[model samples]
Target: MSTTTIRVRAPSEVDDARTGPATGRLRRRIADNLTAYGFLCAALVCFALFSWYPIIRGILLSFQQVNFVTAPEWVGWQNFATLFADPLFGVAWRNTLLFTGLALVVGFAIPFAVAIVLNELRHAKAYFRMVVYLPVMLPPVVVAILWKWFYDPGPGLFNSMLRAVGLPDLAWLDSTDTSMLSLVLVATWAAMGSATLIYLAALATIPGELYEAAELDGANLWQRLRHVTIPQTRFVLLVMLLMQIVATMQVFTEPYVMTGGGPEDSTVTVLLLLYRYAFTYNDFGTASAMSLLLFVFLGGFSALYLKLTKSGG
Candidate 1:
């Protein structure tokens, strides 16, 4: 056999070899953690400055009268009392509730129906989806302005169409009876696209086998939708319902832009009233109180909803 040779590494050399990569890896890991934490801290600081600060400041302002010219004056529950005494307060709240209810009924169902139709369509889906989502992509102010034009009592697009059909022109935005409903329709049209897309995504996630099984069992189209599709999308439906409620309850844009809280104040919403208090009336205290009330109501409602849904699940 050829002569065998063996080389022994020194203990120091062995230790250095063993520790070199480990040390480098440890340093890299520490650096990565530091970088990640730095980003997170930056995000926290931004949120603190913007969101938390605003919320805290509003709460404090709710108990104090602060006009830009004068120093803030502390008043205990006076702003709330003022709100209670104001007659328009009750009307604003009632109209806000009415808008939320009407928007929910119309805005909620139409999106789901549209999503279902889109999911079923096999031809030119991309084109149709673009059409549906076009409104959502447009700026809210532009949409409100465009619809305002459409709702014009004379020579408006809707009135023109009505006249073409030999029907009398309805006072869409002028009459109190139709004003809130008109706002609701505009809100629905503008906001429904996003909800429809979400429903479509949820529908797509549903397994196809269930539908095939339903068909084999002689279930009709409605039965398939009722049994297979609905149960599968129940979670999405509940979540969207809550979000829609919250969003509609805070509606201000359409009413402020189109109606200006008019038609006998029938279209006034909570946010529109809050805006008036802060800007028009120069009463920041009352505006803060209105905001606080809205926040509390929404927080409690959301908590209760989550609890109920958790238990049901």
Candidate 2:
């Protein structure tokens, strides 16, 4: 009976009450977004300054001629034309392709094989892993110097071993036939450790039941590898293959330090040629042009890789 005197609130008041919490939540979300962006600003600034700016500047420089003393002058496609006309351009590309190919065949395959073997081993896994990765920890300069000594024609470890084993002594780095191979061998040795560890990690992630299932189906070692192991790690293999190609394309230090692009320029790589263009030739525009060309090539390859991976996935 007392409810007869009850007062009803306005519809607008009720609506306001319902929306109050949602308004607070929206404000809080806006504040959170602002905070996140504030935190990201520093990294964004650094990337713009150091990475993106240089890339843009390099692109601009490719079409301009500039030395430190004078203002940059636009030269259209002159730099690119000069680059193409350079005799070393073809040689550099050829050597780079050869290095990439050999590295894929030897460096790429060896690491995966090593990883497979290592994954199967239950004994001294840590020791073996350490041994395999030790070279990667060594400084690149140190590795280069050590391998230089190893490849020495006289009193070198490799030739000494050959002598001890009564095998013919081969010029590891001196011969035009073997200089590039020697570089590949050293690069593989120093670099394979990382790939091996990566493959090992990838292999570990694969389900044990896959291997068991294959075995139950009477799959032998080779069959299991073909059907299960490789397929399971195919994504990693493709990524590593692309990475190796990119890396070998830019090879410079090994050829510079080991052979100085010697044995009739057998080891001259794209990066080494770029270095000579910039430093030895003092042609910054041409160097920038070469850099742009290399960037475009690698970028195209990366796009293709992404397309393939997306479709495969």
Candidate 3:
């Protein structure tokens, strides 16, 4: 009787042991999936509200005239036609392209060089990185205002430094010749911080053995950097290039705050002109049209860049 009772209890105990952990694991997996889905749903909702909604609204507005005073009137392609007819439209595009080119030449290379230097340093890296990134921490408006003061013809820091060294002060923003380049400098200074940190992270990921192998093969610093470092980080470089181009093309803040598209509209940009249409001119349709064009352009450019990079890779 004792043996039979023990056998019956053993079977039930084994079943409980088998099911207990499996049930717990199933519950945990369900909980994890629920949490992941909750976060994803929230993200989708926010993008729908903020990003997608505005894009759809802008697309609609591009087809209709809205001044907030009258009922919106559908105008078909009138807005785009008007944009093309405007003289400043051409100037805005030209200046925007010029600025983008200058920024790519200046802004894209400096951060990489700075990152390499920082990575090679033996001491006080954190301090230098913070210093380099400090400009980016400040507000864009504040940065523009600060640089505006620095570029002031009468009492600017740059002029002061020039005078201290007995050199003549150039018309940094007042002259059309120097205005765009000056703005590029301001932008490059303000944006290089994050790029530098990203590059530092990329640099840190490179395996030590490859670099050691390069050294053993009698490769110098530049050789190793070209052959080892750059090849290893080609994907990163391509992505950063695309990002920089996109960002430079859409630049607005520094020019807005500093130049106000002045010095004979030498600093006018596409976005700045778009702002004028929306608020200054009260032609939301034209503004929307310009934004749509810009959006399509950036989208195409991004696609092309990614394709080319992928193929090259």
Candidate 4:
């Protein structure tokens, strides 16, 4: 059969035809990238100025003495040495650790348990959620002040209830023994809502079929929770646990407003101690050193937590 001869275009010609669109695409991509970077520059600059600069400056200040008046004088480890020598340093660490442990035991689990219960409810969920989160909506200062009134020895709600129940009126914040617990109570009331909501969200994501299968295997409520619920939500629980530790360790406002770290300095936390170093003692260098120490401790704790969780998972 006779066929018409077709002329093939030269490779160079074909490349030339393709080059224009390729160059256009490259230019367009460069332009898009430049536009994206231009948009990101403002956020980058703000983060650098506000966040990164403060962290670097704080570290530098830890090694230097400054009074917001004269030039900062570099003093090596003098600030850290002074902090270590301070009598309140050990007390602060002890109180902070105690608070963190108590908060973990009380504040951390309560939210998860509440979330589990709330998840099972078929009605009044909205009302219960609103009630649970109501305290969180109030200002922290207001909550502290409110709890201060609640913990008052005279005509306070707690004492009134105790008296009504024929129990002796107990000194809540006034006692060194109960001051930290009182603070933990208020913190739990104010903070547990967020964690509860987070847990509720995590619980919702769990497939119902898993529970059905678990039940089919003759698992009871506690068994199912231990085997399925906990393991499924283990990551979230661990994250919340670490977060509670960090927050409790840095406690300040409750003790500052309620007890002023009083009742024999029983409620003094690491952050409250840091505040004293900076303001009460007028020693910025030592405060910076303490802050750096706290940062390092929390960072190490977080790293350790991640490692443990990863290994467990």
| Best prediction by TM-score | 4
lDDT of 1 by residue, 232-270 (tens): 999999999999989998999999999899988988888
- Better structure of 1 and 3 per TM-score: 1
Cα lDDT tens digits for candidate 4, 1-313: 9999999999966776788887767877999999999999999999999999999999999999977878899999999999899899999999999988888888888999999999999999999988888888999999999999998999889999999999998899999989999999999999988999999999999999999999999999999999999989988988888888888888899999999988998988899999988998888989999999999999999999899889988
Models 1 onward score TM values of 0.91, 0.92, 0.89, 0.92
CA lDDT, every model vs. true structure:
0.93, 0.92, 0.94, 0.92
Q: Considering every candidate listed, which one attains the maximal lDDT?
A: 3
In angstroms, the error of model 1 at 149 is 1.1
Writing each residue's lDDT as its tens digit, candidate 3 over 95-141 gives 99999999989999999999999999999999999999999899999
Worst 10 residues of 2 by lDDT: 1-10
Error in Å for residue 48 of model 1: 1.0
Which whole-number lDDT from 0 to 100 does residue 276 have in model 2? 91
Using TM-score, rank the candidates from best to worst.
4, 2, 1, 3
Better of 1 and 2 by TM-score: 2
| TM-score between model 2 and native | 0.92
